[model samples]
Target: MIDLKACPLWLYRLLPFLRWWPNVTAHTFKADSVAALTGALIVLPQAVAFATIAGLPPEYGLYAAMVPAVVAALWGSSWHLVSGPTTAISIVVFAAISPLAEPGSPQFVTLVLTLTFLAGAIQLAMGLARLGGLVNFISHTVIIGFTAGAAILIAASQIKNFFGLDMPRGAHFHEVLIHFGSHLTDIQPWVATVGAATLAAGILARRYLPKLPYMIVAMVVGSVTAAVLNARLGQEATGILTVGALAASFPPLSMPDFSLTAIKQTIFPATIIAVLALTEAVAIARSVATRSDQRIDSNQEFVGQGLSNLAGSFFSGYASSGSFNRSGVNYASGAKTPLAAAMSALFLLLIVLLVAPLAAYLPVPSMAAILFIVAWSLIDFHHIGEIVKRHKRERVVLALTFVGTLVDLEKGIFLGILVSLLFYLYRTSQPSIRELVPDPAELRNPRRKFVAKTPDTATCPQMPILRVEGSIFFGAVEHVQRHFRNVDEADPDKKNLLITARAIGFIDLAGAEMLAKESNRRRKLGGNLYLVGVQPDFCEMLRRSGQVDTVGEDQIFRHKGEALQAIYPRLDNEICRRCTARIFDECHVALPDGTPRAVADQREAEAALARLHAQGATAS
Candidate 1:
């Protein structure tokens, strides 16, 4: 075994696969081989289906799943994440490039290759710049909603092929539904029968054979059913169509359109694709990592996905992203390392080369039926139900994202992210500010704990203890200022303010400046602001901002007890003599001016009160 710890940094940086290449052994190789074969079989149908969705020839999907998968497996951080053609990327490709040129034409394919290259370049740059944390801003609710919408779109797009309807190409989601409804009488019964058979076979295979690849099984059944029907009913009677045989050669070297016009048209779409691809890749990587008990590096994943797409564009493939189905299956099939993903691509290439001619037997309706199953599986019903049944705000995000996705695919995710952010900012802008007072009940207890101020609790009229429960930033400065103003407005005598800073999670320059201004204002009122249990970082911020001088360094204490001890002497003796709420230990001992109080009289008063309490209890 190679000692990775002793390996030089440059080697690891140049060839990241070196990190895990040392772990490959005979035992792991056998495990990975089993997983690779299973993944290869699974991707065969999905690749073709995704290609159909993207308006590309079916062979291009196989090409994408080969080179790109290998590149990403070797370069990425996750052990089980498999990169290939996915439904979202397929729809995005079709949506982005369909307007530029005729679908499946030479010009359309060139534009797609260019777009793939550009998106890969952008992803690579972002990874190099360490911007992988940007995906965190996109909430899980947004993903759930967007996925549900995309699933519906996927099903809608296949309706024409599934039922042999005369729906126009590249129709909108609602338009597809409308066309399907209008053409209900025109549906070919033979095509529908094939699709129904395929769907039923897929559902049954998945239910009975949990470890088998249901998609390939479904396709076989669908093809056999379609072939039998076409043979029995005759070609003229049955209007069933078959997907033509795919090319058998390896992926050829390709070039993207570099014309200025093509570049201009595709630039914006490329950016959208880059963001969407990275999000999908990282999310899938992390999801697989959770089950495998591995830590994923998001930045590394970004770089890996970028490199994979770049490789794909040069090798006769369209844009690709991480595939959740393959990755999940890779993990569930007992893959022990990233080698399984890399090897799956090789196996897929060999399998496709051998079976390319056999694709002629695969019915278009059968592929459509299999895709319907894939689409339904993508919709996470359990999570969606939980979001709707439990959280109100998250449900709003989920609904908006789902509806927006049905309207527009890319913008739906953006809208969901925007709503989630707005909700986050609104909540952060209003921090919880509470007034606390020392509990008279725990007066003699060793541990001092403060409780929320209530009518029954007697608090010092001159000094109010306040606790802030969130960060104080520019967005929250106004709220914090208003809170401070309300305190003085309600009780002018409460000039001395004791702020418990332990609860303040963060404080910015605006917060420190506000503290300085408040300190100056209190000084003018013949009082000062005291901070108790202040965090060291906040103290440093205050000192660096020059607010420590305004709110005297002596006023800042490490413990609430210390601050209370120092501020006790500053209260007025006349008020202490007349006060009945002996909230502090010092209040019971002497007057504020160090004058000895009648300790014997205080003890006698306490004894009398105890006797009254006992008599009241006896009466009850």
Candidate 2:
């Protein structure tokens, strides 16, 4: 306990686990165990499919679920996240390796292992460097759109097996459709029957039998149904297929090819897989964390996922990442710690060792049907509806991501993130700059507070109060300048401009330059520019950027009273003496030159009122 407590503050900062070490308990252990068992059951079929997608042997998928799941959970921030083989990573791996060598060949497997290793290395480096902010670049809109699209693609890919259609292996989306269309007449009715039956049973089990493992139940029903059909119609008459027998064993120790040829071929493909896998893992972790109200550390998650894959590469496993189904099941089952993911791997190893041979009776159509359910569950219908009804831009992003994923798996998510970023930058580049008028109705009683008010010609002429909204960055320079230009263009004779700088979110060099330029321009016209309630960062930027020199130091004021006092002298004496517009305390006194305006004289007051009327000015 003292050793744990003796950790330096900086070390604790770098490795946050030191803070949470004290929270482990018997209750947490009990919760984690149940979640782990549930996760193991969920991953059983998915591991096989994912390994097949990644161009690895059936057992490799199971191996991927073993060590990697535990490693990620042990080091990761999220208690519920279970990292392992995922469809997106699998498809990406297939795409990457297929271009280099034939699928299922030794060369293909070697290249995939190398790619996994490299990806793991990259993720680890990023985590150590605290580059977790990379996740922020992938906008929420992009993730939502991309996941929805990926879910559809998952369903689409299974159509061939579900209908038992003759589509060529590794067919692109367009090619799959064309192949299916050409072979439309060749659909096997018996295979469809088994698939549909399995789908229904799974759906019903999940909806009604909440305690039962739905996927396992559905597989059993489909298998039993297929077996009966095979017996009744004779093996040759009923062409229902099964997954064949699986090899029963623990996660085997494996080797990755370190050959130059393999590295050269695998590096590019590995990068794609790495990025996709990292994204899937982080997104899953974040989703579960959100429901639990947990503080998830992205960098720590990166470290965990990286270590898991690195271990997986040596354990007869292909590339792997987080599984939403397993993670969600884990959370719903009430997992309390990373131990749940660790226990899941342990349970899977035991299950595989005992039940591997039994998998031969499991039908392929049943697996496909189960995947359809998983894919469907991934689609958040309510969130999609919200996106469509509330946010038009996000809806477009969702559609694009979904379509793009259908067309090409690797590029869809990347495209969505790029599009979202562009929209964000566009908004930031043109900040809102508004000319403001004081709430004349609330002036006398500050406690009266503000109501909706607008400016007009009858507004105070001496001070043109304005509000600068949003950040002032390099890209926003032209917009801020144009706003200032338009301010005096409306009425240059007003002579004084008061800027309420509170709404100005942030400022950069370009913003400071524009401010300096505007100040000089206003001074040239004999009008003074005053700033009120400037933010610290904005003021610091002005000082450091040397823009404070261009705009005089005394010119920056903190409040309306100070600004009025400073600009009083700069106003035209002729207009002030003849004017009845007593908009400020300074206006009630003599002119800047100290010549009194005898407004006490009733006739002078009449002339001033008439002049004010002529000028279309109002008194509060």
Give me the candidate number with maximum lDDT.
1
**Residue 378 miss distance in model 1 (angstroms):** 1.5
- Clashing residue pairs, backbone N/CA/C < 3 A, model 2: none
Candidate 1 wrongly placed segments (more than 4 Å): 1-5, 439-441, 445-447, 452-456, 596-620
Candidate 2: minimum summed lDDT over ten consecutive residues — where?
444-453
Q: Mind giving the per-residue lDDT tens digits that candidate 2 earns over 250-328?
A: 7777788888888887776666677777777888888888999998888888888888888889887777888887899
List all candidate RMSDs to the true structure. Answer: 4.8, 4.4
Structural similarity to truth (TM-score) of each candidate: 0.92, 0.89
lDDT of 2 at 246: 83
TM-score of 2: 0.89
Mind giving the per-residue lDDT tens digits that candidate 1 earns over 59-164?
Answer: 9999999999999999899999999999988887887787678778988899999999998899988988889999888888988898898889889888988998
Model 1: worst 10 consecutive residues (lDDT sum):
595-604
